[model samples]
Structures are given as C-alpha cells and as structure tokens.
Target: MVSYQNNISSIDNNADADIPVAQYVRMSTEHQRYSTENQQLAIAEYAKRHGMRIVRTYADAGKSGLRIDGRQELQQLLEDVQKSDIEYRAILVYDVSRWGRFPDPDEAAMYEQTCKRNGIQVIYCAEQFSNDGSLQSTIIKNIKRSMAAEYSRELSVKVFAGQTTLIKKGYRQGGSPGYGLRRQLIDENHNIKGMLKRGEHKSIQTDRILLVPGPPEEIETVNFIYRLFLNDGMPERDIANLLNNQKIISETGRPWTRAVVHQILTNEKYIGNNVFNRVSFKLKMRLEKNDPSKWVRKDGAFEAIVPIETFRQVQAVIEKRSKHLDDSHMLEILKAILARHGALSAIIIDEEDDAPSSMTYRNRFGTLLRAYSLIGFHPRRDYAYLEINRTLRKRYPDLISEITSNIEKRGGWVTSNPDNGLFTVNGELTISLVIARCKLGQNGRNRWIIRLDSSLKPDMTIVVRMAICNSTIFDYYILPLTDFSPETLPFKEFNTFTLDVYRVDTLELFYQLTSREALQEVA
Candidate 1:
C-alpha cells in the first residue's frame, strides 16, 4: 500500500469505518442554491438519511467550472484519493454540476472513474437516482454534465452580447485604460461618479465605466510621444529611451519599453475609439487574436487625447516605414549596428534607427538568441546564461515526449496537458519535469538551481540537472510534493541524507513506480 501518513492533514482519525465520507462543494458565481453553505446543508441532510458521517470537506469558492486548472480544492481531493491511508470511503457532492461543468463530459467521467477505481464512490447528494452503477443514473449524469456545459456556453454568449451593447453605448467593458487615460465611474444616467484608481472596480451593477483623459502632465506626455514619433521621426526605442532619460515611467510604474511606446502610437483609445474583440479567450480555452474585420469598434467613444488626423498620419507613416525588408537586408542592418556599438542586445537592436524592431527579429528568427547566433554574436555575462537556457528550453519538449512514451510503455496512462506540459499519470499522479542548469558554487562544487512552478502543484516533480558541459543530463531528482514546496531550490553535488535519498542516476525507479505487474489466477 502507498504510504501517505504525512501527505494528508484533514483526515478524521476519530471517524469509524461505518460510512465515513467527505463532502465536496463548489460555487462559480451562480445562484445561492449552489453556495457552499447551502450545498453543505443539503449534503448533511442526505448523509444523515444515508447513514453516512461527513468527516472532511473540500470546497472551491468563486472558481470557474469550465476547467480544473484553478480549482485547488478539487485537485487536492483527487490527489488525496490516490493515497492508501485516506480516511473516507465515499465523497459526497451537492450534484453532478458541482462535481464539474467540464466542456468535455468525458473529462468529468475520467475524474469520477479515477475515484471509483481507487475504491472511493462519488455520491451526488441531490441527484434523483442512486449512483450504484445503474443505467438510469449513468444516463442522467451524462445528460446533466452536457447541460451544465451548455449553460456556460449560453451564459458566455449573453455576456458578450451585453458587453458589445455597452461598448456601442460608450461604456468600458473590461481592462485598464491606457497610459494617459483614467477609468471614470458613472451612474445609469451618465452622471460622473468618480475616477477609479488602479486596481479599483465598480461595485454597483448600474454603475458604468468610461475612459477619460488623465492628469494634464500625462496628456501632455502622450502628445509629446506622438510629436516625437511623427514630427521628429524618432523610432519607438529612441522615444522610450528619451522618456527614461527624463525620469518618466509608463502607467505600469516601470521604465518605458519600445513595445509600450509603439502601443501608445497605434492604439485607437488615444483617438477616442472603443475597440473590442481584438483578442478572445472565452470559456477558459485557448487565446485567439481576432481579425480586424471581426473586431467590434466604436469611433469617438472615449475622450480624445490625440487628434484623429495626427493618429491617422502617424499610422500611415508607421505602415510605410515598416515595409517588409528581406532577411539579408535585415541581417545587414544588425551587422551594421553591432559593428558600430561593438555588441548586440535587444535594446541595442531596437534602438538602432535603421534596423527593424527586436520584436521583428524575434518573429523572423524565432528568438533574439537565434538571431544573435545567426550573426555569430555570443555576448558575455547574462547573455551566455540565456544561451544555455535557450538550449534547455529547446530540449524540454523532447524530454516531455520521452517521459510520456516511457510511462505509457510501462502500461501507465498519461494525459499530457498541451497548455502546461504537465502529465497526469494513470489518472492518479500529476508529474512535472523541469530542467535545472548546472553552475559552479562558491565552494567550487557543481551546483544546480531548480525552479518549480508551485502554482500547478504537481504531485511529483522530476528535476533533470544538466551536466557541467550544460549539454547532457547529469542526474535526476524525483521529489514528491509533500517532500518539497519551495518555488526555487538550490542543490549541490552532495547534500543531506534526507534530500540525497531522492537523487538518482537514472529514471529506472520512476518507471518502476508506473509499471504494471500481471496477477496470477488463484484456485
């Protein structure tokens, strides 16, 4: 049996074997019927009727049901169920929808199957039919899952339509107003309410948000940026540098970046236009950049800070200046900049008046590092470390693929999430693999820095350390989440016995963890 003596802390030791159960509750800004307190009341009543004792509770308050990515309580519950010393025999949820409104109904089923496979039954307290592997229950559950998913889709459409209407009505929908603008709160009749500070929002439903001109200095600075770009024909990088030189920072309270300057020059908000649907990330799915034709726009919606004619002229000039240059020409520009400055960096490349923006180089060559490599420019200091990181990044996908293949070969199921490159093994363990770059320590010993993504909270993390040459795998450290929790960990060639115990030369032991053994038939 798997030892989980130290993993779970919420188990009730006093609860006896006569029907000890756990309750799971989830709320996603829905009606009060789905609130945690109400759900718990219903669950408690059902448990009493069913002769079950509730020993623990798991809840996800104000979380979305579209995906399990942000549902920490649900993730923890799934992780706990796989352990042998779990105190509960069954999990009681308010309803099937509370279990999850997963877009793919199969995802919800897979989670349920994981619990059932581990001998823990998932009991929906409010469902009409019994969850005893009956045909009626299965059909109803599947239908309910589909209905839950459809509800989210319908809500998304209604919300989008409402937002589009508000946009046309000259009210802000979401996101912060740009650098030289401020969010103004107003009433239903458009009476000026007040200016919203950063990170502030309207609490009343009837209140609306509008973009208005900010401080006079900020407005003047906005105009200055346009004049510099249009009249003086200063590049975005040069404008950014000039702002920084004058001790002026962007709205984000950071030194200005070339991209930030370019955004100010191009965005229609400065010209009082409301633009929506430039990008879409609906229902917690993939992000997509919508075409200009698909964008919802309203001309003269916000308070204008820059003249529309000037904005138009700047746009035209920018279009003409950014006319496509062939790869050879681009390289020649980079070579010229490097020869003049005696070095090349993103800032240097962007600062050059005759060269394309560093972003353009990234788009053309995949990365600035790749562009530098093409020109045989190996920069010193941090740039050398960035080169190493680039190589490790290139190797990460292959490593994930290799690990997935090996796990599957051992008869273990692997569900690889394309979004995060994390693997759920056999529907029980979530595994994350990270590459640790090798460095020389102060003591002159080989050291490695392991940065784990604590947000994902994988059940197991495999740190693949690079050798001294920074090309090959030095060794592996398979750490369970219970054993380590820091976001960053530094390791030497040697360590304490407790930590060194987890270090290994190969992944043979890891494969064994996922390996399946055939059982012999008994008479």
Candidate 2:
C-alpha cells in the first residue's frame, strides 16, 4: 500500500495533541464552487472545531464521483486505511456526494464498510448526522447516497436536453467537425466570431459552435470523394486507398481507413444537416446505437460540403448495397466470389462490386468465417490466424493502459498517441509495443514474427510473444530500436546471447530499465 504521508501537516498553535484524522477532498467539475481547496477549508474548520487534528490529506481534483476509476486519490485513501499500520483514526469528507455518486448505492456502502472494517471512521463534515453507528445515521446516509445518484441522473438528463436544443438551433453539440469542415465560434446573437482550432473551445458561456467548410484543399478532397463514389463508381475502400496513397490524412491526423471514408459517405452532416443523439451511453453504460427514429436531426443547419443530390445518390448506393440482399443471397454472392478468386478475404469481398463489403458479411453473419462455413468454403490451412489476430487487436488498448498505469505508479509520466498507441515516458524516451504470435515453421520449429513500426521511431520496442494458444504471453523482448534495424524480425528461439540479452520473463525489468532516474543517469 502506498501512503500519502507527503501531504500530511499539523496545526502548530495548539499545545495539546488532538485526535488525528485524514481529510478527503474531491471536486468533480470546474463549475462546482465547492472546489477541493474550499472543501479542504471546510474540513479544516470542522476538524478544528471538533478538536481533531488533520494529519493527512487526499484530494482528487476535477475527477468525477460517478465511479472510482479515475479517482486515484480516493482509491489510495481506501488502500491506506486497509493497511495494518494506519495512522489516521477517521476520514473527513465534505459530504456524502464527495465519497461518490455511484449509480449503485451498495457500492458506496461497500467502500465505507471497508474503511470501517479497518477501524477508520468516515465522517461527513457538512452533514448533520453524527459519525456514530446508529440506525438513524445509517438511514440518513443511505438516503443521501440515493439523493447523490439522483442528482447525477437529473443532471445528465438536463445536459442531454440542452445539447438537443442546441442542435435544433443549428449549433454543433460536441465532437470534432468532420473532414473538410471546421468549427466556427459564434456568440448568442449569431455574430460570426472566429474559427476554433483543434482542441480549442470557446471560453465564453454564451458562445455557440457551428460547422463551416475548411480549407479549399480539404473541401476539394471532400468533393472528390463524393464524385469518386457517386460518379466514378469507386468503392469506399478504393477511395480510402487513393487518399492514403496521396498522403492525405483524415480529420484525426491519421491515415484514412475504409470506415472513416464510409462515415463521410453516409453521415448527413456533410449535407448541411445537424444530427444529434445517434448514440446513448447514459450513466456510463455500454454505448448503444440509437435507432434512426430516435435520432434528432435538423436539416440545412450548415453549408453543404457535397450537394444534396450527390449526397443522396451516395446514400442510395450504399443502402442499395447494404439492404437489398438477404442472408442467403449475400452468402451465395460470397461463394461465387470465393470460387472466382479461389480464396476469400475482406479485401477481396470489398473489391468485388457484386458482393457487399466484408463488414456487411461479418455483421449479417456472426463473423466472416461463419459465413464462409455456411457457404461450405474452408481454407486449406488452420484459420486460427485470423482469430489470433483479432484477439491481439483487442488486447492492444488494454495492454497499453496497463503499461501506462505501471509506469505512472513508478513515478514516471506517460504521453500516449491514440493514433498508433506509441507513447513517451517523461518526455524523453519513446516506447512502442508489438505483440508477436508464436507459429510453427516449415521445419516444425516454434517461431515468431516481430514487426516494428519504423514510422513511430520509438526509442525502445517491447515485443510480447504470445503462447501457442494466444491466450497469454509467453515472454517479452525489450530491444532498443537502434539494435534492431529490420522492420520484420524472425525469431526461432532465445538460445543466442544476443537474443537472450533482450528476453525477459516479466515486464517489471522493462519498467526498471526505463525509469526516469535510470534514463537521466545514462544520459
């Protein structure tokens, strides 16, 4: 357990020692006037009045009380209380809401029980109830928890309603203006203010955001995409490829993907329509795509990038390709394409105008393989390769988050690139992780392929070789980018000294090797 002893302080005026307690302060939003500092002041006044000395402080600034995920200080406070040699007898919170507005009241109770189990009482300074364990206090605390949760529910509803109103009035609710469009800031009086750059928002409360056409090149590119799809009859994937070949990046500053291209082709915003609430993630639950009927839309909300007729033509084409075919017809088309090409793949299916895109097949059937099986077409070799690749793709984000958390726990800062998952530690050493799948070579020897992203040019490359089953990692290879030049590295075993030098059984050594202190000393 990690204790926050560094934040501990004492009041020097009192001669006699007072009961030691820890003040826990949290501010969920900048709009809230009861900031962490204000909470601390209130807690200190309460402690002083009650003849209690605040020995430690744990504060989470600008952290939501909806869940414990981002509240690291609160998590540490619980951990410290659970320790056998805890120094504080009680914890002072501003109110029950400061503890949490967890959707489930039981969750709040459980955390408080944990602290109580460790003999550390949780006292709400602003609440009227005493800290004593009585029936009345328990009832009041439970009611307060429910009220906190209710407050969040009410606030979310109000915020959603406000956003819907804004959308109806032709204001961009949130999120980036898509490719070929820029966010324009305007005041409540509808006076054109100025263009808002990426990651920049209007500082005024009454300012509204609208979408306007971006640079001439980006506008031309958007028009070209529409013309390519509607007039030239190029598929979304081909258009993406063409843009990527031309080195044109998407609005996110990343290489274009078929999905990104398709989104441009389908979204109504490109045709000067304001659409809102197409998806709902209320109470931080899993996101669910709302039905078309549930979507709130306002037409002619902005200047159209593509002509309405051209946009409608593209949508008609997409809908004709998507909704015209039934499951059996789609499968039959896939079978015919497989027979014609002597193999089946996403790219192959996408390239064939006669067949729907691979995404359609995967969504219609559970997966492409399942559709292939239905068509009685199986590959010659084991098709677990695709499954293994899918697992690795899903594991990458989680692994990056875990690695980042580990680095932070060791007193290092991490800056991760969402585009490629490349990250830098302490703004000095960049690191990239690649997962290698174990395979059997022609000689019947276990082998692995480690592909490095040379474009990222990370200082160190951490390669995780998965087991044969692809369920868990076999071992790790922490190699410096300078030591390895090949984009694609083949490994048979770790018998050679050169290979063994980079081999590690765990990632602990990797963190130790890349510590800021260690890197600074080496520098």
* Leading candidate by TM-score: 2
lDDT tens string, model 2, 393-486? 8888778888888888788889988887789888888888899988766664578867766788889888898875465788887888777766
Q: Model 1: per-residue lDDT, tens digit, 236-303?
A: 88999999999986897656877789999999999999999999988877667888998888889988
User: For each predicted model, how many residue pairs clash, with residues at least 3 apart or on different chains?
Assistant: 0, 0
TM-score, every prediction: 0.67, 0.70
Q: After superposition, how far is residue 322 of candidate 1 from its true place, in Å?
A: 2.6
The C-alpha lDDT values of all candidates are 0.82, 0.80
TM-score of candidate 1 on Cα atoms, chains taken together: 0.67
Candidate 1, poorest ten consecutive residues by summed lDDT: 1-10
Error of 2 at 229 (Å): 0.8
Pairs that collide, model 1: none
